[model samples]
Target: QPALCPKGHYCPNGTRFATQFGCPEGTLSNGVGLQDASECELCPLGHYCTGVGIHGAPRGPCSAGYYCLRGATTRTPNDNVTGGICPAGHYCPAGTSEPIDCPNGTFSAATGATDVAACQACVAGRACPTTGRTAPGAPCSAGFYSPLGSA
Candidate 1:
């Protein structure tokens, strides 16, 4: 007798065993007897699916300091995880699928900053020369002055 395959798994016709094939990574199945790979749904947005045989849910949410789009296979893509590091001059809040650029007149020195608050305002007398500045750039080029938050 043939039985329905379990969630996260698929059994093709003439299959001898239900677990003969597990759904590939980046996808999940919530119901039993998934017959084809297409039955496995892509991991939902803001989530990552890193493990094999994921049945009821994705491996987990994309970790902090990172973002995951739909079907993300890892937490952060920059050697540490999967979805790709929040680039310089940008911040990524929790569950963010994309990095948000720091507003003008602000800058971030770090790459994994998690919030807009991480983008520091240009200090008094210093000019943030660019959109994504690691440090308040050259000191107003001597003589010329800038107020706080100057870009």
Candidate 2:
């Protein structure tokens, strides 16, 4: 008696055929019939898929220090990971995985920096006056007024 083909395998007019069957869409055949279709798997945390088909081959993993920017499928050979770069004036301590902001008194003139130099002591006549203040506009402390007033 003729029977319906399996979900993934091929059937001719209600006749189930085991061999020469095509794999279901979005899946790849690793052998024959429904049992031959290989389930698609997600790329590893540090890796991404660039193309289709899974025949015992693993997708490439992102390089050390680099992170995946967007969600990608398929297996490809060009995927890579990049290290975190800090901005100017900012310091990303060694072994630190994420970017950190420069201290309160420090400033970053650029992006992806790693280290921040102590803010230049407020100019000779000018003083920071406060702990979190930087830049040349900071006012002088009490009893230590700037001779130039608002220079």
Candidate 3:
């Protein structure tokens, strides 16, 4: 008889069945009956909604070195939680959603790096130019030499 609540599941208010409730993790609910649960939606930027209900789709992306951000429930983000990894100098390749600096010249103290050859160059005397440089820069001020990779 009473229909509705379908999209990702959600009923409430005298709800008889209809999946009772699902949309949880980062959120989704494409819309159907959705009674409460904030209506569900988030889980966008970078993606990672591992609620196992919404179905709206999103349990992907945010892998490589790591980045995510938005509602990322868990795709890699570590240290504590909520989009992390790929720090030092930045790199994040694969599904990387963000953090991709390390450009001008080249530098990377190392963290998650996934692309750009892990940014290295610029070392001879140190220069780096600047972009996300984790190191290499406070050494070419004597007579300005810079040779190795410079930048």
Candidate 4:
């Protein structure tokens, strides 16, 4: 006899009811009828599996512009617990494990940016602002001119 295995549980070929193995805190099971413990899959970056013996279909995807680290199984929306924001000075697309720094002449002023559009270009006449997360830095002081992206 076979039963439905939840996302956080591992059901072997002959697993009994409720006796299934736990997928641990950082892993999960996406489907049912798992024949081996190997079926337990790692929760990819930007994704989570909070409950036990659950399915990935309902609780997956760590939200756009946010990266979910490996072995992570919980929703951490800007809370910095289960997950974290994209952060300033960088752009983070959906389902990313890390953020990419804004290239020279470009800057990002907000967190959780889903695309490069979040990065703004520095004015050619103004000195690049030393500030992070904010693009288009303040204009150079009187008489102090600067080329594009000048720091």
The lDDT, on a scale of 0 to 1, for candidate 4 is: 0.67
State the C-alpha lDDT per candidate: 0.79, 0.38, 0.79, 0.67
Residue-wise lDDT of candidate 1 within 71-133, one digit each (tens)?
788877564334777777888877777778887788888888888999999888888866666
CA shift of 31, model 1, Å: 3.1
lDDT of 4 by residue, 31-133 (tens): 6656666677766667766655554552666666776776556555555655677888877776667777776667777888877877787777765545444
- lDDT of candidate 4 at residue 99, scale 0 to 100: 72
- Candidate 2 error regions (>4 Å): 1-85, 93-97, 116-137, 141-151
Q: Which number leads on TM-score? A: 1
Per-residue C-alpha lDDT of model 2 across residues 10-104, encoded as one tens digit per residue: 43443445433544322332332233334333334334444344333334543322333222332221232323343344444433333444444
- Residue pairs in clash, model 1: 76-81, 76-82, 76-83, 77-82, 77-83, 77-84
Candidate 3: the clashing residue pairs are none
Pick the winner on TM-score between candidates 3 and 4. 4
C-alpha RMSD (angstroms) for model 3: 8.4
Model 1: residues >4 Å from true position, as ranges? 79-82, 123-145
Please report how far candidate 4 places residue 49 from its true position, in Å: 2.1
State the displacement of the C-alpha of residue 11, model 4, in Å, after optimal TM-score superposition. 8.2
Q: CA shift at 93, candidate 4, in angstroms?
A: 1.6
| Model 4, C-alpha of 30: deviation from truth (Å) | 7.7
